[model samples]
Target: MTGDVGRAIGFAVVGALALLAPLLEGRVDDRVAAVGTVAPFVVVAAVAYLSTSGPLFELFARPGDREEGRLYGLASFSLGIAGLAVIYVAFEFPVSAFLVAVFALTVGNLGQELTARYTPDPAVGTSAFAVLGTIGAVCAMLLAGVLGASVPALPLAVFVAASGALLGALIRSVLFVRDDSLVVLSVGLVVWFFLELGLAPTLRRVGIGIALTAALGYVAYGLGTASVTGMLTGVLLALFTVVLGGFGWFVLLVTFFGLGGLASKYRYDEKLDRGIAQENEGARGGGNVLANSAVALVAVVAFAVSGHVGVPSAVFRFAFAGAVAAALADTFSSEFGGLFDTPRLITTLRPVAPGTDGAVTWQGVVAGLVGSAIIGGLSGVFFGLNAPGVLLVVFAGVVGMTVDSLLGATLEGDYLGNQGVNLLATLSAGLVAGLAALWL
Candidate 1:
């Protein structure tokens, strides 16, 4: 077999063994089971060390840097063994966790190899890294949980620091084909340390949520529903909500995005035929997402931080609800209004084209109200808002939507853009909600 084919088969065999090791736990003799458990790690370490001289080296190393590549490869291999030893001796991770770690390492290395070999498509390479990073994160979380149970904080911290350092070093070598180990090591340690402290219980959920959100965003970009920058912006927004507000907030955000996306696509061809469709054919950009969500993200951050300062959490809760409600309202109004034949300008109240700036129609107005009410109702249910609180959110949404139109009529496409208008509207809604919360 060719060298590449031989290496591929070897990696595949190691992965299969790692996966099956856990299943063979009780069935085999004690010594044999122990050997099985350690076999994968040995294979991995050997591959990491020997790969520098093999086809795998060509994948990760630039043509002119073979010597540096060998040094980094040896360092990575040594660190991998050291990390496994720490897990085995210090944390005493179970065979299951070891198997998971082995599987993660295998998958990550495979992804790295594939990404390095395929240089034609940058998106594919990015996607591969994203997938592998996500898998590694999940596996790390699982291993951390297993080791953290009944352990003191100090040991947990040590474990996290060590794992981060090793992984960061390996990643640097793979990505840069050089040894910038300390830089990435410090970054990884700080990031993982904070993650452990802030999101200990929800690490797995956060990992899975982020991974799925990234996948969805990529799909949206691929489908021309959103730009690449928009997809990245959405991913950050989703990550913040998932980390700060938990699953409920994530759900609320997803609901609004899904509904708004569907509405944008409704009668798309008809809108295009009439020359009234959205610019870029409704493909949103980073500016669009941030305009609608920046205020909400600020609220989430404020809410998260308020727990330490004895501030009432309701303030930020209402602010978040109002911001999201305004975003939904604006989206529904703009998208559905374009379907009306004789819309009227918000400022002059005279007949205007369906998609004219500041245009409004009865059907569009009702749709906007319904959309806002949906978010308001969900906030009430999710955040324990009273009747008056819900009403205040809905009121704020309506006011914000009106403000958007007023701004669009005068400033949009003149001194301001669509993103600027959306930003001001959402900010106004958040401010309104905050003020209302003081009274209610």
Candidate 2:
């Protein structure tokens, strides 16, 4: 236990120094600063191997395992140097420099943790250490910014710290089952780095929006409307919206999910009695959410990134609209369509079971059309598409719905599953919308 405490302290101290070196670049000679920046990480790698009681220290350690350890060590060293380079390049922007430094340290530590054969003593878990270490490192970063020629923005600092803490705690909680403390810290750091780099100025604006979305997702999980994995997936989807499309897109996504969830429960008892209800008693999982929203999210990202590439931004908007509309159409058809007793096979006019894969009913078709129309109208309002654009979106959604049924009947349960059918349907809708935008 005493040895464990000592090791933990040593790890924390080394991490703090590594994080602080970037802040000291202005105060020391260039060569001295460079050495200081790289030394801590090298030491960490050596300690990770030498401190372990496992075969890690045996010069004759299993050849394969020894090579792996060497690779991890090299990776840690390279990442440390790369991190220093990013911080140096972004030195003019204190916030960017600090964030990059945090990211570098995270990667190095994670590499070290994964490569090491021995688990650290249980005196302190990696998660708690990460939270404390990150807080300290961030504080050092802020101090460095203050002492340097340029000052860090107060709002940015506060945002980084708060976000880091929240992400740390969330990651630790999620990875508790694995009990690998460093892995948890590394995952959280990487995620934060992505958000900070991707969102930046917008992150400050949409922080509250993301928080609200996360809270609602958790509440839904609590209410048994979504599984725990589903809730996490929803949070990721919400973050993607904030980063890729801002508040309007997030609102549309939430509206679709909320309404779809409610509709799923409307005739639950009847569907259950008919033995055609959704699995997990209507609670959606990560896979289900991903199946429905992945294409839309991809469209939003493409639109956001294409702004500077001279791509007509409107084309991407249409793609986004079509994908969302298709998802809504498919969801409504499945949830509400199952409640009707008049379902028939789309391939043939023969009556089928209520929840038959290729089944369609007039009531369900109308419900899907209504769902698609709602998305189309919202796309017009949010994306500024004219009447022609709106109609194109609606038409594309209906096409996707038809494609989904055709695919379900022919491919589903034999060659393709539900997720595959949904993906193809949404892809078809997005392509059709893109084509319509070109022609009209």
Candidate 3:
């Protein structure tokens, strides 16, 4: 048999054994069960170490990388065990849920390898693997429910499958990391996180989330506003926003995306002549999507999990808007800054060339304010934010925009890229709004 197949079969056998923990909960400590699940990986690592240049080494290692595969493979096991431990230990979720997560996730990996081998097209293989993995995960979750775990089977199944598909794709395609260890950690962490938060999306909510995200993502991809990977990442974020944050949050996110696309497309020729066009004619790639929206995604997710953090739900809601507001503000500040006025350095107040980093214009600042006010007004209507809250959102947005400028003028060109600056600025805005919600 192939080494890959052999390794997968090994995982299947171990995963099956580990998943019995829930059934044995009355008699065995779950922690002990976790250790037992991890123990095999240690044994594998030892074999990889001692069996260098032998058949066992070949079994543990992928071609070309040889022994290095063992490192990633062990790391994958460690991360998976740790993520499951967090769910079952720190949060004290159903041991069955934890064990099932372990089983379902690795099973999906095994399934992926098996399915990918015969598929000729890489794209088809990926899609098939994701579908098969989702089916396997759903089956595992539903079966775990029958075994008496307190998990919400169908809802959890949909979420876990969606998350796994996206995360598995992300770690491999976008992040360019070793997926063996990290996919398990990241996907399992997100899955268990939802379980811990008790954020159960009704079937209708899930359906709406899927429908809206798919439609918008397809539109965006068709319009050249986002690349294929960009569309997937955006859709995943939108799904979480729609299901967890509901309409109030989802609308703001959509508005933000719309606003960014419009801003990028406006007067494209003029910006191009100025030698400051958005890179790649404003087509957002995976990195761009992640950099720009990571803050908003975190805000929405935090809002969903806020009840456990002792923060009021409204805080995360406002933070979400503020994050988008800041992102829009930055987009407007950059895209239109040179169209109407002479730019000045934000830090020095000295006249500077248009497109110069950290340069600002009166028109751009006003435009940014308009963007923030739009978000604030929507927040009042959708979020039921009082006047003060609306005002705070605007304030926080301005703060975020300013942070972007300050970073751009000083560190952006020299120390950080535009994406990095955008991330930090948006995060600052989000934190400011969250804090303002708490204090003011």
Candidate 4:
């Protein structure tokens, strides 16, 4: 009953916006383009509302009528509308009016809800909707910056937006938009890229990279519930990763991890039961934790007179590059594994069970190896690490995978689960790979 009422209200609001669009578009003056500018929001809102309950809704809606999905759409509508209000107040741009309207539209789309509606259980829907709303909001901000009539921020905005969009699309493809994580990633990367370019003058190069990437990450995690929390998280992470590390490696890491996380999270609802939407809960986040921790541990140990030891520059580069390769391999292996494998246990080559913890198939192993190889090869080109360094990464990746599986199979299995274990394993792999690249 509440759902129906909410939907009705949404419909009404969208309808009102639609009606107002033409009036504003045609009647409003050029200086503001307020009326016309806002029309897109109305269009977006109408599309969103209709999307939830209209023609395409049936195609996408889950069986048995999902109230949560509908409610999420409403929530998104409200949030988007609110975001528009913020933009309007902050910038006083005429386009702010339209921003409101488009936000409403995206709210209606509830891409997150659309993706989650089919799940038998609503638990996943909660996370998915939250993820979608955040991604959508970030995208909205970028869109505003890029499309704004003002000429000054245009180039920077466009570049960041374009980079973000390209990265987002790439992430969407790699993870295949079935999950909410891609939305999270798309939003984060785009925002970071935009700010990195736009605020280059105001913020330190490293600071901008750190801040923007952090912002992106926080938003991606659905940590936007408390804007400060997510932003801070992203900031700290970026500072440690991208800001401290060189762009060549940091950018790729962000790109890979951001996309991989998104891809790993969320899936087509109906497909959830069939394993179509299923992901390794264990592997989902472990690598990042490990990666960050390793860096931190190294920093701490080297905190005193770090310059004296003179850690080989190549070692740092190799470690960073290796981390990137390991992450890529992990994503590819997990993403494509189900498609081609018999799901053999990592311990023995024999087939065990599909979705088994620590399971590794020939298909997955080979694919992971390839993924690492690609990253290693790229590292060679970017850092001039040489064939030996590249080979070390590959070897390290294999070891990493083994470490990851071992963690999953043993100590990590006890409490941390796959997510924690994988993170650790990857970090270990990256660090080891780095060391190997540096020495051998």
Best by lDDT: 3
TM per candidate comes to 0.62, 0.69, 0.77, 0.46
Q: Which lDDT tens digits does candidate 3 get at residues 321-437? A: 888888888888787776755899999999988888889999999988888888888888999989999998888888898999999999987799988999998999899998888
TM-score of 1: 0.62
lDDT agreement of model 1 with the native: 0.63
Best by TM-score: 3
Model 1 lDDT per residue over 1-440, tens place: 43333443454354444434444445678567566555655655565656556556654334433765553433443345335434443443443334334433444445655665746454454445445644553454445455432222332333333233224423443354333323233333344334434434344655565665666677767766665556656666776677667667776676677677668878899989877776677777667878889999888877777767666788888888888899999889888877879788899999987677788888888888988899889988888788988898888888889899989888999888888999999999999998688666
Ranking by lDDT: 3, 1, 2, 4
Query: Which candidate would rank higher by lDDT, 2 or 3?
Result: 3
Greater TM-score among 1 and 3 belongs to 3
User: Model 4 has how many clashing residue pairs?
Assistant: 20
Candidate 1 wrongly placed segments (more than 4 Å): 1-113, 116-124, 134-201, 211-224
Clashing pairs in 2: none
Write one digit per residue (lDDT tens) for candidate 4, span 14-46.
Answer: 424423322343345643444343445545545
lDDT of 3: 0.71
As for candidate 3, its clashing pairs are: 76-181
Worst 10 residues of 1 by lDDT: 149-158
Residue 165, model 3, lDDT: 63
